[model samples]
Target chain A: MLLGVNHKTAPVEIRERLAFSNDPGVPYRELKAIPGCEEFTFLSTCNRVEVLFVSSKGDETERKVRDFLFAGSMSYDEAGKYVYLYKGEEAIQHLFRVGASLDSMVVGEPQILGQLKDAYRTSSDQSCTGVILNRLLHKAFSVAKRVRTETAIGSSAVSISYAAVELAKKIFGNLKGKRAMLAGAGEMAELAAQHLLNQGIAEVVVANRTFERAVNLARCFNGKPLAFEELVPELAHVDILISSTGAPDLILHKEDVKPIMKKRRNRPLFLIDIAVPRDLDSKLNDLDNVYLYGIDDLNNVIDINKSERDKEAVRAERIVTEEVLKFMLWLGSMEVTPTIVALREQAQEICRDEISRTLANCKDLSPKDQKSIEKMASAISNKLMHHPILFLKGEDAPEDQRRKLAIFRKMFSLDSVSRQDNGESD
Target chain B: MGDLLFKGTFLLYLLSTIIYSVFFFSQNKTVRKTARMFLLGAGIFHTIYLIFRYFEAGHTPLTSNHDIVSFFSWAMAWGFLSFRWRYQIKNFGSFVSILITLQLIVAAMSSSEVRELQPELQNILFPIHASIIITAIAFLAMAFCGAIMYLLQERELKSKRFGFFFSRLPSLDALDTLNHHCLSIGFPLLTLGMITGLIWSKQVFGSFWSWDPKETYSLITWLLYAAILHQRFTVGWRGRRIAFFTIIGFVVSLITFWVPSYHFTGL
Candidate 1:
């Protein structure tokens, strides 16, 4: 059973309220009292809060889990309006999609895969996941890997920092040995600088209103801190300038950037202004060899990247569907095989008893005739069970397969074997 | 025998060109690997063809339009393969292969008849000069590819449309770096080749600075490249502007190499 509320359903207020504040290990402590929950794993992220658990009384367990999470503030019916609950096959499919990032708000984002792995790992360490979930989660991970390798979904940059880096690439061609200047030590600007560094931008210079803040931010990234007054001079040496200062007025004007472009010998300069009021004059973009992008531009790039990823998602969806079917087939065979085997064993045992009784009574028959009679009896039972065995193993829809399996077990009185195979007896 | 090898090389290049186009669209790892293998195979056959032509003609095979164009195509393929081996830009082979095949087709259209080497072309410096110049042209061709990619990728980034070409092409930084690397490699070789040609001209024609159309064009091509290199190092001229300059340089080189060789007998 899977119960979760993601960004698509719940508002941030509700999600944060239900989130485990500090300890991710709190679920196991609380789940100890929930009866019939054989295994449990809780996943809480910025975008989602979920619990995947194995329980014989799935409906009751879901209610209890919801009550525990919402803490009497909401009932199951009210929660059902926002929360998604998946049982058996639906739950498995949900896990696969989540692992593949198809269920993510950002369709092809890579973070969900790693997050899923972390959730699985943490749960396993806490003894909350066992044989079934262990196999299922690992399968989900491999499916995610396959999706990543087989499609171009994760190839483009879709975030602000990434978009800035991508724009820098457009202006300069390659960032290797190129220098980047951070006009403000704002978090967004710092993120863009880090992205540039990862793309092989050789040097980073951070300039902030507060010298100490600049020094602290620069030290974190192993970068150099530049004095705020030196921003104009430092622009000459850097290929990219990311500005996100909180100043009321513009920090850079056309006049300030024109000379820097000249000093740099008309080398391309990329200006990324992430600040709301915009740190640089828009007219500075008109300078030759200068490319300027504000926050809106980065968002546009992200939108483009997201749309491209959405197209590739069609292919990824097909792969997920194929994997889900394969897992379901494996699961179906797992649940049905023991009952089929038990039924066949019962048939064979009855055939042997009937053959033994006939052979003992028919003393006049030759030893060869007695053996032929036993063989005939065995063949009759095998022929009778052949169609049933084929039906048990054949490809049917999940619902139809379940119905047939239940009927097969009841008809043959094989509930004990089925229950044993399921590791449950009720 | 040599003609058979030439035809084999041409067919292999054609096959590889198609495969590379597929690789570009699909971006499949297996298809990329196969396309690269085909390019290598074509290069081998092309090398053998060039060697056979050299042995058959008893000189470096840059005497006629057909020979020189084919030789240029061979150089481009070899240059592209070396770049790919070093940089591992798998998508780049699509563009380079198309350019190579286009050159080969132009070569095929021209008569393959061997022409007698003119008196001034017979000097030892002529072969050295021609070899270096042709190799440089190959590098410039790669630079041209990089420039085109840079412009297209830049457009994608600026417009935020993120279309098929955007996904298919490498990053702007990578393309820019490729363009820069190509320019650096090509410029010096071209300079050396022009100097050698000047020396050869002095030895044959008693003048090192003749204003022949071909020589004038070579000078123009050389100056354009020099300016590009200068601006790149000093003024920090890069990306779209540099890419455009490299493309213009390639066109000028083509005209200088092709037009003068067909119309003029000697330098």
Candidate 2:
């Protein structure tokens, strides 16, 4: 069933309005209210809002989902444009893309995949996913895997944290024995510091507005922790410096660093001013060997990585498309197999009963005659069913024949055959 | 100990470079893989050949202008091999292979006249310095890969074009981190190597900070990383800017190695 709202459907306010509440049992209650509903999963992230369900009523059950999303407090007219509906195959593909990070606000983000899995697990734990949803979720996992393996999208480094380390290596020919200072200890700064550590920068010092955040981030990246105020005094000790904070304007200006540069005897300092409104003063680049690059400058690296990895995108797309087609073929084949099984089992049951009754009625018949009668009945059933089952195996079988088989199963009261044999229905 | 092995390996690297360049432009995946494998094989053979030459002279192979340059290329090839082996990255190995091959070609051009091993080169400490220095450069080679990634990433963003190389390269953050991590490990190793070198120099030359071309270049390389570390920690420079400098620094270090040896008449 379709259940997602994005930038197209909802504004930031509306999306945030329908975002996940602290209440944990809301999913179960909402899903339980839908008719024929057997599964309930919701994936809510910064870029998307989704509610996945398994209901035989399908689109007819949309009203309940609508009510759950808006709580019927307002009209759908205001926010409906931002929503796109998907069902069956389309819905499955959407979920797969979402999980694979292809549909993410930032493509190739690894977080969405884990979030989708968590949502799915929550539904499963609440006894929401029935046979249909179970198959759908499993299929989503495979599609995600196929995307990851066949595409280079996931390999490129796009985030700010990685870009920081790349810059560090640039200023320094080699990272060996270099020292780094991470100021503000914002998640961004911490992440950047981690990248610095990974780039082979040995000594790392984290200084944050709050001492504890610095300590925590330092501990996470295995860097030496420092205090916030210690930044100015220790400025000369570091080779590369990263800063991110909530300060509205320039916390580090040319004035603050000019003296440090002089004291350091003109040794270069590569400063990464990553704050949105800008952290360091732009004029600081005037200093010799003092390379200051901003968040936008990181785009250059991001673009290049995006292209290099994009070269493999065609290969990955072909894989996903082929897999989807293969899945559809298997799904198509499944319909015929069930009807054939239903027909054969019914015919076999009748043969056994009739043969046993005949043997009982003729008490004078010898054991050899009875055995022969049973063998003959079995042979007739096998020979009768062989051609029909073989025809079902054809990938390009006639639609009329397929439909007729379905009608036969329905007429014979065997439409609800065992579902255990179903395979790869995406 | 003969010049033929050195020349032969140099030729092999040269051949691999052409093959890799062809594969890159032509989009020949099979040929690219083959060329990289060939480069790796050449590197292996080159290592054996260098070791034999080192033994023959009863000194480190990095003693002369010829062998040190050759060793630098050898280190780079080994670096490429390790990076490819660790990541199983199939396509980009050729880029670094070409670079390493060129390094060896330059080394081959330098005088390989086989001068007598000097008394300063007599100590076992000499060989230790050679190994550490080569190892440090090898790590830098991985850093170079990161730099290439950074440059490629920036170009893609500017052009608004994304392709296979675009995504295959590690993330801007990942590459930066990789560059940083590689440098961190390599820097310390280099520090120890430099320390050992200083101790040996002090014992032999009666001085530790002579500012020889090799020593000066090493300091400059160290200072470049020092600046990177400072900027990353103090300010927030990253990605392409960082990568550009990392690449430049490594290239300069390469030049420094070659230029100074020629002055010292290791050529």
Candidate 3:
């Protein structure tokens, strides 16, 4: 079962109230104290707080887990309004979706997968999860990997800084040996400059109105500090310039950049003007080899990228569904009833095949004789399957029951057909 | 045998062109590899065809309309392949293969009859001048392809449409570098080809300079490339302006090839 309150269902205030500390021990201690709770793993991220557990006492354990999560934040009825509960197959599907980042606030972002792996690691390390969760979590990790490889969900840029980097790549082909200049100390400019540096841009030059701020920002990037008045001269040296100054008017003009292109030997220049009242003139885009994108333009590119990711997300979701079905099949096989049914079906199939082949050879036989032969074959098959079924149904610990079910399925080769079926579907 | 070889070469080039076009749209890596293999095969077959024609005609095969245009196509194929060896420009082969196939179609349509060598044109300098000039034109043709891609990519970037050409074409910087690389090699060869032609003219026509239509147009093309190269180095003219200049220079060079001259009566 899975119980959680995420950004979609809870406000930040309510989410913070239930948010656990970073120390895994604290949450595990509280989670362990919940009555009737079996093996469990607790995941707390900025966007969600979820508890994945395996328990026979379903309703009681769910109530207790909810109380543990709420913990004086609200009444039980009010807490139910914020929390979502998924049992059985739904719970498994939810876990797979989360592991694959399909349930992320920013869909297809990679952080959720790492966070889930960390959560699973903590739970397994603390001996809080048993056979079911161990298998389930591993399956979830593989499902996430499959989704990542089979789709392009994580390839497109969805954030502003990433959009800038994508555009810069389109202009420069590669960022190595290229230089970027941060025209102001604004947060957005700093972020874009950082992204460029991460892309292996060779140097960064920070220029702001106040020399001290430029020096501080430059130090953060291990870059050069330049005076704001020298920005135009620096344009000749840099391939990308990000400006987000608080100026009411444009700081750079077409007239200013027209000459710089000549000085730079007509090398391509990418200008990102993220300021509200744009720092760079719109006409800068008119110059040959000069690409100027204002805030709106970058947002437009991000919007397109987001749509592209959404299309890929659909493919990712399909992969998740496939993996969920496969996991569900495995989960069903863990149960004694399914294993016994599969064993009987396999035995009957073998009997039918043998009887039909024998009847085909003795075509002179009467219908009554053929019917007698089919009855004898089924009786023998039933007698053969009786012991294995009894052994699977024997009363034992839940862990031993799982082991018996696995052994029974393997002995009869019952799951082999279903595995082949899955492969054929793929 | 020569006709059969030429037909085989044309078919191979056509097949490679078709595969390249398919790869351009699909962007499948396997398809791209297959397309490149077919193109390489076509290049080899074209080389064999040219050698066979040279042996059959018992003279350099750069004399007839069919031979000259086919040589032009062969030079383009090798030029493109050589560039691929150095650097990869996205979807470059697709565009270049289209040109090669079209040139072959022109060669196929024209007369392929082997012409008797003109008595005066029998000098060794004749073949040298023709082959060098055609090879130089081949590099300029690649520059022409790069310039068109540069313009298309520049339009996409400037318009911020992010449409079909945006992701498919190479970067503006890469395309510009392509133009620069091709021009740097082509212009010098073009100058040398022109100088050899002048020397050949002095030996065969008793004059160092002539005002033939082909000569006049060749000078114009050379001057245009010279101006473009000069501006690129000193004045920093690049991107759209350089792209346009390259296109114009290539068109003028094509005219230089087609204009009636004492040297090429096969047309």
Ranked candidates, highest TM-score first: 3, 1, 2
Alpha-carbon interface RMSD for all candidates, in angstroms = 3.2, 10.0, 1.1
Local lDDT at A416 for model 2: 43
Q: Global CA lDDT of candidate 1, please?
A: 0.80
Provide the TM-score of chain B versus the true chain B for each model in turn: 0.96, 0.83, 0.98
Model with the higher lDDT, candidate 1 or 2: 1
Chain A vs native chain A, TM-score per candidate: 0.60, 0.60, 0.65
Q: Best candidate per lDDT, number?
A: 3
Cα lDDT tens digits for candidate 3, A172-273: 989999999998765567667866786789999999899987886787688999999999999999999999898899999999998898889888899999
lDDT of 2 by residue, A266-300 (tens): 55587877777787888887664577777777766
DockQ of each: 0.33, 0.07, 0.63
lDDT of 2 by residue, B205-234 (tens): 888878777788888887887787677666
True contacts kept of each: 0.57, 0.00, 0.97
Interface RMSD, Å, model 1: 3.2
| Ranking, lDDT, top scorer first | 3, 1, 2
CA deviation > 4 Å runs, candidate 3? A1-147, A185-191, A210-222, A311-426, B262-267
The worst-scoring run of ten residues by lDDT in candidate 3 chain A lies at: A417-426
TM-score of each: 0.63, 0.52, 0.67
Q: For model 3, give the interface RMSD.
A: 1.1
| Regions of model 2 farther than 4 Å from truth | A34-36, A56-60, A72-84, A87-90, A153-426, B1-267
